[model samples]
Each structure stands twice: as structure tokens, then as C-alpha cells.
Target: MSSPQSRFYAARLAGTPVFDPIGESLGKIRDVVVLPQARAAARAVGFVVEVPGKKRVFLPATRVTSIMPGQVISSGVMNVRRFEKRSGEQLAIGDLLERTVTLLDGSGRATVQDVGLEQNRHHDWMVTKLYLRRIRSGSGLSKLVSRGQTLTVDQSGVKGLFGTDTEQSAALLLASYQDLKPADLADIVQELDAKRRIELAEELPDDRLADVLEELPEDTRVEVLTGLDSSRAADVLDEMDPDDAADLVQELPEQVAEQLLGLMEPEEAEDVRRLMAYDEYTAGGMMTTEPLITAPETPVAHCLAMISREEFSPSLAATVHVCRSPLETPTGKLLGIVHFQHLLRERPDRPVGEILDADRHTVEPNMPLSGVTREMATYNLVSIPVVDEDGRLLGAVTVDDVLDHVLPDDWREQDEPPATTGQIDLSEIARGIHDGDTGSEPAGTAASTTTRREGGRG
Candidate 1:
């Protein structure tokens, strides 16, 4: 990153075509990883690259070539494949994510999508830079081109997510971007000091700034609040989840938070204020105060109809909680979680309870984040509802938020074991290398052993 005074920002690379060894075209960039330059580190620690028309793929600062106004060039997609091959084994999802892809969108973490896997006729399997689309859906930054002139792809003149470049290689990898995916864009903003945060915030578009602000630490939120106008600040908060908005507002001085909330819609601001009463680190705090709640008795069609009226989409309808009473009066109680996949699986006439996660593990209002984190692991839950002493459903905790809890600050540098590393003892390790653990591992290895170990490796 360059000094704020400097017009050029080394870290805010908006456009750069990533390449594979043989010049295979990958995607253009969205944002730079822009890690905190902890203690005079010559290079950035992480790199956040929004694959044009895809999710942000994090590259290490080591992979960065040059950071410019409209672009950031990077290196190392080739290395991902080579590293996976040398180990002579199958890589885990986390292994592919070991690349330092930062979520510059402000959310702290991301997920692994499709790993660039290739299998030869000889059955040699190689893992590559899992071309992640997005966590849930693909949507990220677009590369900036000559004013009004976007990069067009391969004579088609069709622009990609970040716009496409001509003469693109067929091997170009792209990922998805989803509204639910968590991004580290907040951490990047936090990494900057007050002045830089403001400067960077000013440079970013309002929508992008809104996301980064929502994702940043509360204290940073307080510091950055002074940078934007009261209206702008309120607008940013308005665009955020009510819970996240409260989180940021709580960080500011009481007067400021109050003032910003005042600027917001009275109902939304009130909801955020109610959420602020609880400590953010706890279940009461972590769960959203205003989630899409409705009565289980409500006809599915009616509920869906009402859902279309909601300001936010029912995209997270899987986690859409239901109760017998209205959201205000609160009765009946949380019957179950409605899994979108299941809802779609069953006929619309089937009750919501039938589709709800019968076995979902919920956290109490006072439960600590630790409990929430543990449940996240135990159930592999995408979202967990938080209830009160009466077991009344409050809000839910989604997986993207928990991802930060799973990974360290320098997660990109973390080394993950191969799929067979767990099963690899002295003998199995050698057998895995020579005999092949890429699925076929002597079917008679005992169903129980394979069930627990083979699946565990995955």
C-alpha cells in the first residue's frame, strides 16, 4: 500500500490478469488482499483477488507483481498445482484454501469451491488452485478498464464479472460470489490507520464501502465513522444487516451511535438498538435480532408471498426460522429450521416443520461464542438458531461468520495435511503414496475403517 498522500496505491490493484505457467488466462482482479503491514514487512501478507465474475481468490503477498491504480498483477496459480502433485496425495478442501486469498469485501473468511483437479489415464490425480466461484453465489469486483471501455473477452465482446480480456485462454479459472460469503475487506480497512482508512474508504465505491464498513472491527468502525458524513454513515448502516449495523454503532460514542441511528428508519434503528443491549460476543449478540420469522401455520404459499414483500430476499430461507406467533407477540416457539434444499425437495404443500432441521443445535441467549463455535463444528451447520431460556428462536449464526473462528490471522500460511494424512500412519502413509488413496484404497479395508477414516480424510 502507498502513502495516502501518494496518488498511487500499491495495494489497491483493481485490474490484473492472473496467469498459469503456460500463460493460461485466469480471471481479472477485484481487490488487493492488502494485509496489515505488520512491523515493516516488505511485502503484503495476504492478497485478495476477485476473479472477474467470481469469488475473491486470495493470493499471498509473495505472489504480487505490481499494484497499480486500475490493476494488480499476481503470480502463483501454477505453484498451487505443483505443490499438490509433489506431495503425491489428495489434498483437502482446506489445503486448496491455503492460498492467501483475503476477503476484501470486509467479511473475514471464505470457502473452498472447485479445486483445479486433473486426472491422467494413469490415474494420477493432481490438485490445483480450486477455482472457487463464491461461497454461496458468485459476485465480486470488476476490473476497471479505459474509462467506459471494459475488457472484452475473446472476440465475443462479452464482459466477464471483472470484464474479460481478449485472446483469453480456455483454461481460465473462475469462481462464484455469494451474498452470504464472508469477506476480510473489513480487516483490510482495519489494517490501515485512521487516515488511510478514510482515504481508502473515500476511494472505494459507496456499495463497496458499505460492505467493508460492516465487516470491519467495531473500533475501526468508530474511527472510520468520522470519515463519512452522518448521512453516508447512516446509509452504510442502513445497507447492513440490522445486527451488524448495531455492532458498528455500539463501537462509536453513545451520542454518535444515537445520532446515526436517528438518521436511520425508526423501525430498523429500533431493532438495531434492541440488539445493542446484549454483549456482541454472546449468542444474544451473535444472533440477528430481525431475521425473516413467520408462523409455521402460515400457508407456505402465503409465507412465500409475504417473503416477496420483505426488503431482503428469502435467499437464506433455509435458515428462515418459523414460530406459531407473529414476530412481535412470539408464541408457538421455534419448531425447526427450514432447509432451502429440503423445501425445494418436498412439495410446497408440505409443512415447514417437515423441512426444518429437526436436529439443529441452538445456543442460548447468554451462551458464549465458544459454544456457538463448537456447535458450528459439531453439526457442520450452515446456520444455527439462537434461543432464549424459553427456547424461543431469536436469530441464527451463519457459517461464514464462524469461518474466522476456524482460521488464524495468517491462515493462508497454515499448512494443511493431505486427505490421507489422517489415515497415514507408518504403513498406510507409504501405501497411500504408491498404491493410491485417490478413492480406490482396497475396498476391503474394512467398511467401518473406511467409513470413519476415508470420509474423515475428506
Candidate 2:
């Protein structure tokens, strides 16, 4: 009801931490839930907050006490139910960005860059400002170098924002979310309806989509992949880790899976095919074929540089597999491995082979998931190497891979209520918010859907 700032831009508000009155962390503001009006500004009813465990729930706007630079203060009476879009509710970042609108003075149309929300005299928040960028035409060198005029205008200065004929795309939305981690971006894609999800996925670069696909649930990954043409789908698959790509391929129909494999480049497809040969529960299936690898003769300095790459996940970079020539997986004999710590403590000029961890354990490809788990636990290692019967390195299985297999199939979905914070009921609090004596208010509801579903901020 009270505020540190009278207005806040939706994009800047996103990912801002939310805190209880006592200064304890609740979660983060993921998005604003707004209801559009025919001739009035859209009313913001609540927010989609991503709480602990990546679970998203609704936070009524009336309960927020202040919007500061890096955080939001709340009354802490949250509705722990998974947030869902009602019949007419629209997500400010998910559904509104990139909407084409006509200028009031008959000026050229522009796309919605961002929207600003502020509380009215009645303490009800509404979208009252818009950031617009003029639409530009043509492509090539000129298009890349030229700039479009941008404006900061009152919401009433633009039309067609909520019209059926308005052209809306995912271009600007994706740009606004460009800084989000792949996992965070995947959360947003999962919450969108099937149509919008595909639209956003199609607009992402192959490499970016590949990273996002690896974080998404199996069904959603498959759905997005199937939405693309075979050529593009294969390209995305190539960009993903072989193990993840194989897992996704297994979820597809046999014929469709084979077709996609054929469309992929021979080298990339070969890795996926090899991974698919083993049972899904075996170490072979869980290990990534693209682990950080180096030849025994490679300098420790070089191995350290390889592990430092941004592309490698922390688990994968924990140790470097040292093999004979043909440093790639399935290389000559698995000589040994050098942990990053070892590489760091030794002289930079030393060869990695001199610093191998003699006590490290290796697992056979056929080893079951249980065996892999025990191997990692017993050795106190972040990852274990998988070697062929002939003593050649096949790949390395990380702790994350084992957890993925051991956890419940639907672990990613946030269907249950959050840990209890208070005894208050959200419905009662919501009712008190709108019943106040406010002049000429637009009618709307904060009621969520009956069927529980997975969702997150966009």
C-alpha cells in the first residue's frame, strides 16, 4: 500500500528479490499480472514470484509495501498456489512486449519496448507508461547500422495495444530477457501456452535454444523440437550436449527420432547414436561424450585453460580426463585424470600426466545407475570416468546426471504448496484489496485456474 518509488518499469522489476517485513528472503519478482481494459490503462493485480525450489506463486500487489532498487518488501501473506493466468489475465513480460501500436498523432507505428506501472490514488497499481520504438524497414548493412527513434509516452498516447489486429511477436520479449540464464529462460518458456512457447523457441538462435532445451522438462523440450522443421531441429540438436540430445531423441517416436538423426551432421549424430546404444539407466547413457579431455602430454597450463571455458558446467570442469593421442572421447587408453585443483598447485610448465590422481575410480559403460551413484559417493568425487572394456576413455558421468535419473520423473513441476509461512488465507487478503472506496475502478479478478500446472516468470 505504501511505496519507496511511485513507479517501476516491468523489465527492471523482473528478477528483483522479494523480502518479508522481517527482512527474510521470500523469492523474486518474476512478472506482473495485468488485466487490459477497453479504454483505460491495464490494471496490475498481482505478481508471479519464483520462490524456493524454482516454484512460482502469485503475490498480490496490494501486499507490497515498497519497490526499492534491488528488492521489494512484502506483507508476506502470499498465495503459495502455482500462479496461473485466468480467462483474461496477461503476463506483462510474456504477453505484452513486442506489441505493435499506432501513435495518437498518426505517426508511424512502433513496437512496445517496455511498460511502466504505478499506483493510483486508491493504491491500486496500473500500467500507465509505455516505452515505444519506431518500426524500421529493410535489411542488410544499413539495417544493422541504422537506429530507430524511441519514445517514452503515456499509455494513452498509443492505440491498438490490446487490439486483435495488433502485430505481436517474441522478438522484443526475447531481447528483454537476453541476460537470463538458460535455466531461467527455460522456466519462462515452460509457463507459456503451447503456441507462444513454440513462437519464442523458433525465434531463439540454435545455440541459445539448445542451451534452453537442455534445462526444460522432457515433454516440453520434445514439443518445442517437434515444432521446428527437420533441418532446424537437427541444427539445434547438434548444439546440445550429446547426452542431453540423446535423452530427448529417445522421447520421440522411433521413426521421427531416426529422421532427425539422419538430418544431423555425421559427427554429431554419431555421438548421439553411440549414447543411445546403452540402456538409459546405465553409466554410458548418463555420461556426456563431450567431457573436458586432453592428451597426457598436454601442458598443465593448457589443460587449465580448457577447463576454464565458459561452455563447461562446473561439474564437467572439476576434472580433466587425460588420454593418449586422439584426445577426444573414445581415444586411446585412459591414462589417468587431473583435477583442476592439482593443475593449479603444480608448475604451469608441467605436463598434466605428472599430476594424475592415482586413487581415482573409473566405471564400466554397462555399470547401472546405482553403481555410478555409489562410486561417486564412496570416492567423494564430483564425477567418475566411464571407460571401455579395452581401457579407452568413453566419457565422464557427473553428479548432476545421476541426480536427474534418481529423482522423480516430474521433479521439475511445482505442483505442491510452498512451506507454510503464516496462517493467513490469500483469498481473504485479496478481497480486502479491491473493496476499498476507489472511484470508477475497472472490474477484474485474481482467481487462478482449478487444474494445477507448472509456471514461472518470463
Candidate 3:
């Protein structure tokens, strides 16, 4: 049995397998439910378990016998009803995770990364504190501050400083959404209605919005972009990966697309135009126009600094393309490539040209999708540079774009249920509870057991 002093993190508890005393698996925990009225030491009433077929079931916390890493032991008897949200019930994972909260000490706002829970002497689980990460703000600062230190705070601090009002909570919640991974944020957006999605998009900064938009399905992406004002939409598009931006613009009506392009800054618009000119299924269409490039004679330290200063994605940062003199746009000539690993091993003060991968492979802008995939597979490369016949660097196609092309259209829509058992009709269970037909004892009866435990511990 777990002790009253034992503590657990909400992130660690999520998806833990639950099993009966006899070793029969019930389900996996999806979310922890707490009553908001309980305030600072909110009591955790139950868990939302994910059963098979993607259905969710609610399990009262009292039914749990023991909690351990990766597993939960149950008393063998559980209500197998579908889980439904009751008024005033706050979910640790669904409601609190990723929500933003203001610090009492006047420090900048931070997003809730996780929640801390501890069992009291009464045998009741309570919310203890929150894990927070600072939000990065400003143009081109997202990637620079992508990684931040985490801080922990107790509930009393939150209520005293952050307020308990709906508007303040909602604002913080929306702000915290920026910290979520693009894929995770996209999943949440897909589950919301059009109005709510629009509301969320309005709160996100352009760069973050661009990242989330790139992860969304085509229809959802179009809907979100169309919902924003033309200028805002153009700004988001400008911030998006060039290939992704082109794909979106191609879906819009010719006039609207043209208007958006016209609104975008010339350099950004030119990049998109270059991508738009290519066949989407070809190498040119799938490549990002913003490949990291530097002059061959540039110092290694300078190259590293540039890599750190720019907001290139991890894969793009993996290799730096080397170009000859006249290093500006329409790069003088494609010289070679320098893998980041090799660059890091060399003396920082040395010129990058000393260690160029002169024999590096290259692909044409017009190469077919299959050919491009074969080339990447053949070389085991994460990114491949695209060049015109004159050996001028154009752009680079990333492996992620290739996977997106080859994967099934509905791949992103597959159901992902929390770790647990099979499904049951929740309405039937609700009816049973209403008619007093459920074989389980009333909640008050369960509370008495905990009350006794509390008295004994005290």
C-alpha cells in the first residue's frame, strides 16, 4: 500500500496501467479529477481511465488499493461507466497541464508543465503544487528561448497571486498553449469547435501560430487561416516553413492567395513564390527555401553563432551548406556541406572551408518524390540540398516533409486513447446511478472510510 506522504507528478501518473488484485487489467489513467471549490488543497476525487476503442471511464480514487511506477492496483470492483465531465470538476491533465499562471513575485508568466499530487493522512489525494516553464516572447526569439528552466509553486501561492476568476484563468490558459509541442497543440485545436479554435489562434503569436498551423490537417489549417484577418493570416504564413506556406496558399482561392502574398514582406513572399512555382510532389515543392547557408571562408565560431542566432529547426541545424564568394541570395556557387557534428569537433577559430564535405550528394529541384526518397535512404541523410544545373544552392528538402508525403492522409486522425481496458456504455451506468441500481456504495459511505483513516492518523 502507498503511504500518505507519497507524492506523484501528474505527468508521471498519466497513462499508468491499472489492474485488479487478481491481475486482470482494467485500464490506464487518463486524467485526475479534482473539485475546484476545494481551492488550494483540492481533493482528487477520481481518475479518468482510457479503455479500449478510445472510450474513457471514470474510476473513483477510493477504489485504488496501491499506486506504483507504471502501475496501479485496484480493489477489483469498479464502476465501468463512460466518463463525463461534471460541473466544477477540474482535470489535472486536461484542465491544468500547459495552462499559464502568473507568479506572485512579479516574475514573468510561466506555463503549467505538470502538477504535483500527494496523498494526505486521510487517504485522500490532493493537488500540492504546479511545475511551470517560462514563456518566450518577441520576434525570432522563440527558438532562442525554446528551452527554459522549470519552477515549482504551491496552490496557495497561485490563488493569492494569479486570482481565481474565469477571465484571468482563461487568459493564462490561452497563453500557456504556446508552450505545447506543435503536434500536441494541433491535437487540442482539432478537438475544439471553430469558434474556440479561432479564439485560440487569436491569442498565439505569429511564429507559434505558424508552427501549430503546419501541424494541423489541411481542412483545419485552412479553416484557422481563413478565420484570421487577412493581415494576420499573411503574417502567420510568412512565419511558416516555406513549403508549408506554399501548400496552404495553393489551397486558397487564387485571388485570396495573391492578396496574402502581396501583404507579406517581399523577401518572405519571394521565398513562398519560389516554392509555389514547383510541383508539390516534386523535390522543389517539398523543400524549405530557408536552408542554413554560410560562406566557406567563415570562421567555425561565426557559423556556430549564426546557427544559435537563427530559429532553424533541429533538422535544418544538423548541417550547414557552404557557398563560395558572393554569399548573398543567388549564392555564388554551392561549395560543400559541413555536418554540425564535424563542425563542433574542429577548432572554433578555424575556417569552415577546411573541413567541408566536398563530395556531399545533391538533388535537383525537379527530382520526383520517389527519387528524392531513394536518394535520402541511399545516403542516410536527414536533409538533402537542392541545386540548379549551375550548382547554385536553391533550397533543401527535409526528411519530415518526405514522410508527410508518403504517410496516409488519415494518419494524423488515428485515435490515441490513454493506457487502459475495453469500452462500456456510460449512459447505462449514469441511469443505474440515478435509479440507485448500481451495486456500489454511495460516495458518502466511501468518505466515511477516509474520515476514519484521517482520525486514526491524526
Candidate 4:
């Protein structure tokens, strides 16, 4: 029999087997669902259970007769279907565990190591507290030993969890996500509900929002863009890379696309419109208009400053196109190409024209995808400039853009393991605390703590 005081951290319950009174095995615990109400301990609603043969079903907490270390005895009733997240429901292990969060105390960020749930007098389980581990830095054994100091806080003390709370100010919330790469942040946002996703999109700055939008799938990108007001959507689109902006606008309905294009600056809109004129599979369609260019007589110092000032991507900045007069827009009369490396090795005062590689290869904007791939492969180039018959520079295609065209349509939809702080062993941390392993000190001693407010339901 389980006592009312008995408790289990979410990490300990995950993967534990469930069985019926007669000892017949039913399934394993996959996730614990709870309702996230503000200022209260969240109530455990049920378990997302994985039955044998790989089917996942929901087993309500009411059907759970007893909870123990390694097994849960249940009344055996369950709904046989895929688990879909509801508006009010949150998963303790699946959604909250290992998520990055900020402490209300103004100490820096920490990862949620585990959530503490306890059985009440009525035999109901409620989330009572949270276990946190600080972000750490080091290498080898020292890194393992000095890993984050662990602390426990009542659920009320958590100021915010990245991508989960929309009520907090955007600047505060965005600070937590800044450490995550745009692709990783996009994955987290995609898991959120439509309403939450829209809220997040509204709060992010245009540049940051553009980066995330570029990483999202075409369908999701359209949905998010459509959800925003026209002016804001146009601002975000304008901030995006021209190639990416063109691709996104092309997916929008003609009326909506035209409206957004009109809202953009003339130069920016012209760049996108020019690319849109080409077939999506052709070199012209896949190129970016932001390649580095300079006159042959331009000094190496001037070129270096342009690259640095513009913050051109590594591939685009790797080579500089040298041309005739009117250097800003290289004319079809191509002169030579200068690798960034060669420019650096020469005297800063030297003219780029003297060091240009006259034999550099170039591709036509209308070239087929296959031809582009072969040219890139043959020359082992990171970026190939696109030009017209007049040898005028149009744009450049990067290796990443090429892969995006060649990869499977569902490549972005494939499941990726959730990101986590790899420093601590969660199960071991839970067991050590439960067993009172002072010597091992899985998490550092609890310094300051806050207890849940009495009688409030989270």
C-alpha cells in the first residue's frame, strides 16, 4: 500500500512499468500530464502510457490505484489512440523536463532537471516543486565534477520557461532562448499551440523572427505569416535573406503576397521580385543577391571593411567579384575573382585587380539544378556566382541552399531528440536525493527555497 506522503519525481516515474491488480503487465509510463495554472501546484491529470507493440494511450490518474518505484498499479482502463496535447494540459516529463528556464531570484539561467510530485490526502498527485541545475562550463572529469549546482524551488518561484510562457515580457523570455540556435528554437516554437506560437511571433523582434521563420517549414511559415498583421509580416519578410524571403512570399496567395511585397522597401522588394521571376529549380531561383563585389582597383582594406560591415555569411564573404566601372553592381564585363584568403595575405593598400584570379568559374542564372550541382562539385566551391551572358554578376548560390533543394520533402518533419543539458544524470540525481546521498551531492545543497502557497491548485 502506498502512503499519502509517498512522492515521485517525474524522471523516476517515466519508463516505469504499469500493471493491473492481478499482476498482468499493461504498459510503461511515457509522460505525466498536468494542468499549468498560474500560482498553484498543477494537478496530475493522467499518464501517457506506451502499451506493448508500440501503441501509446492515455491512462487517467484516477485509474491509477498505487504508485511505486519501478511500477504503477492501475485500474487498467485507458483510451487507445495517439496522445494530442490539449489547451490546458502540459506534460511533466515530455514538456517540462530538461527545459531551460530563468529563476525569479535574478541568478542566471538553469535547466529543469526534474519536477517533484506528491500524493495528497485524497490520493491525488500534484506537482509541488521543481529541481534545477545551473548551466556549467569545463572539460573532462573536471567538467563532470563541477557541473551545475542543483537547487529546488516551489513551482511558484520559476519566473519563466522558454517557449512556454506568453504572459512574460518578450525581452525577458527571449533572453533565455538567445543561447539556442535558430533551428533549435524553431523546433521548440513549432511544438507550441497555434495561439502560443502566434503570441511568440508577435513578441520577437523582426530580425530574430526572420531567422526563426526561415527555419520553419513552408506550410508553417505561411500559417505564422498569415497570423501576423500585414505591416509586421512585411517587416519580418524584409529582414530575411532575399532568397528565403522570395521562397516564403511565393508560397503565399497572390493577393497576400502582392500586398506584403508592396509594403517592403523598393530595393528589397525588387531583389525578391527579380528572383521570383526565375523557376524555383533554376540557378536564378536559388541564388541570393547579396554577394560581395568591388572594382578591380578597389583597395584590399576597403573590401575587407565591406565584408566586416555587412556581416556577410562565411560562404558569401569567402570570395570577392572584381568587375569594370560602377563596381557596386558588377557589369557583365567580369574581370577576375579574388579569394578572401589571398586578399588577406596581400598588402592592405594593394589593388584587388592586381591579385584577381581571371580563370574563376561562373554559372548562368538559367542553368539547370543538375548543372549547378556538377559545377559546384567539380570545382569544390562553397558558393558559385550566377551571371548573365554579359558576365554581369546576378547572385550566388550557397552549398546549404543546394542541399535544401535536394533533401527529402519531409526531412524537416522528421523527429529529433529533445535537447537537454548533458552534464547530469537525471535518474541518478533523483535517486541520490531520495536516498539522501550527501557524499555524491547529485545537486548542490538547497540554499534558499520557497514552499507552494497553501490550498492553491496549479
lDDT string for model 1 (1-458, tens) is 53212122221223456654454566565432221122421112333444433334445434444444444445544222101111112112212322223244443223333233222343222222223322232334332221222111111111121211221111111121223222445543443446646755655555656666655555566777767889888877777777777777877878887888899878778778777877876767766665567666555564454445645434344456777674652234777666555555566665665556667677876876666666665565667777777867767666555443233334332222133324323233223323433222223221111111110112
Candidate 1 similarity to native, TM-score:
0.49
For model 3, residues 178-288, the per-residue Cα lDDT tens digits are 545777778667765687688788888899889899988889999999999999999999899889999999998899999999999998899889889999988899998
The residue-level lDDT of candidate 3 at 203 comes to 84
Candidate 3 Cα outliers beyond 4 Å, as residue runs: 1-172, 175-178, 325-329, 416-458
Best by lDDT: 2
TM-score of every candidate: 0.49, 0.77, 0.61, 0.61
- Kindly report the root-mean-square deviation of model 2 from the true structure over all alpha carbons: 11.2
Over 4 Å off, model 4: 1-125, 129-173, 328-332, 416-458
Supply the global lDDT for candidate 4: 0.75
Q: Report lDDT per candidate.
A: 0.48, 0.82, 0.75, 0.75
* TM-score: model 2 vs. ground truth: 0.77
The sequence of per-residue lDDT tens digits that candidate 4 reaches over residues 1-458 is 54423788887777888999899999989778887657557888878787765545567777788887678998765555444556667778656766777778876667787889888888778888899988675579866865768999877777665255433333444554566667766865776667657877888889988999988988888999999999999999999999999999999999999999999988899999999999987899999987787888899999888777655778888888887765544354678788888888999999998998756888998987667766776677778888888888888898777766654454555532223457423233234334544222122322212211212322
lDDT of 2 by residue, 279-343 (tens): 99899999999888888778988988899899899999999998887878798898888889988
For candidate 4, the 10 contiguous residues with the lowest summed lDDT are: 446-455
Better of 2 and 3 by TM-score: 2
